[model samples]
Target: MLSVMSTRDEEIYRSCAGELTRYATGLVGPFDAPDVVTDAFLKASGSSRWDQVDNHRAYLYRTVLTVAMDHHRSSRARRAREQRAAVPAVAHQPEIDYEILDVVERLSVKQRAAVMLTYWSDLPADEVGRLMGVSEGTVKRHLDRARKRLKEWLS
Candidate 1:
């Protein structure tokens, strides 16, 4: 069903678009951020609950994060599929590093996001929290827990 966005919704979108795009960029990357933001807005605007959401900005942030994660998962799956297909044709290849991959796979999505935004993007905890729609302290907790898990898993 097609949902018609109210004028207020349009206004909210206009106000939040830049920040949302930046947040998406942090979650995904600059190359895919615009597409991710557009996809997120489409998903959010179509939701039945869009009209009733108390915090539209936060809702949009979460939706963008979700879409970005889905994009990441799909990309990973596609690459894995290609690698598997190539395995039969190329018998001589470097062995897969399953241990490191397994360790990364063990991390929760939030932990991975926290680590990526923190270390990969070089974003501070407060900025990560803003993008993640969480408190700065929550971001700190996620980072601390992620560090501990990585340390334990690697050691």
Candidate 2:
């Protein structure tokens, strides 16, 4: 029963957490992923309407996108000063799913968000459109453009 199954509110946090973090990392940078994801989660947790939310996952996702975009702006301004010199790279996480995540990496923010919510998260176009606050046609356009780009790279 959806009732006893840990409120949809918390499920929202768990379900979209990985995809949101991945999208944020791809949009901004991996180093800021955890920070942005944590900020977004904080925002969602603080919202007054969290209890009234019928689709909390979508709400949290939208919040993540907004926070990530903000982080993108803030970091761009601070980038010159913050650029590291001769930082040693570490090995990749062995448990990471490289394929879909790779494809996600290559997409633009809008394209990636659209594709992630639609395909990876299995949300409908209309719901994705609502989450992004764009028209359904815009959602389709994002999907189409993302698909074209993916095909070009994968073919």
What value of lDDT does candidate 2 attain over all alpha carbons?
0.73
Instruction: Residues 91-122, candidate 1: write the lDDT tens digits.
Output: 33345555655666656667766776777668
* Steric collisions counted per model: 0, 0
Q: Which clashing pairs does model 2 show?
A: none
RMSD for all candidates, in order, please. 8.3, 6.5
Each model's lDDT:
0.75, 0.73
lDDT of 2 at 103: 68
Per-residue lDDT tens digits for candidate 2, residues 89-148, read: 484633545575576666677776787677666889898888787888999999898888
TM-scores for every predicted model: 0.57, 0.64
Q: Give the 10-residue window scoring lowest on summed lDDT in candidate 1.
A: 87-96
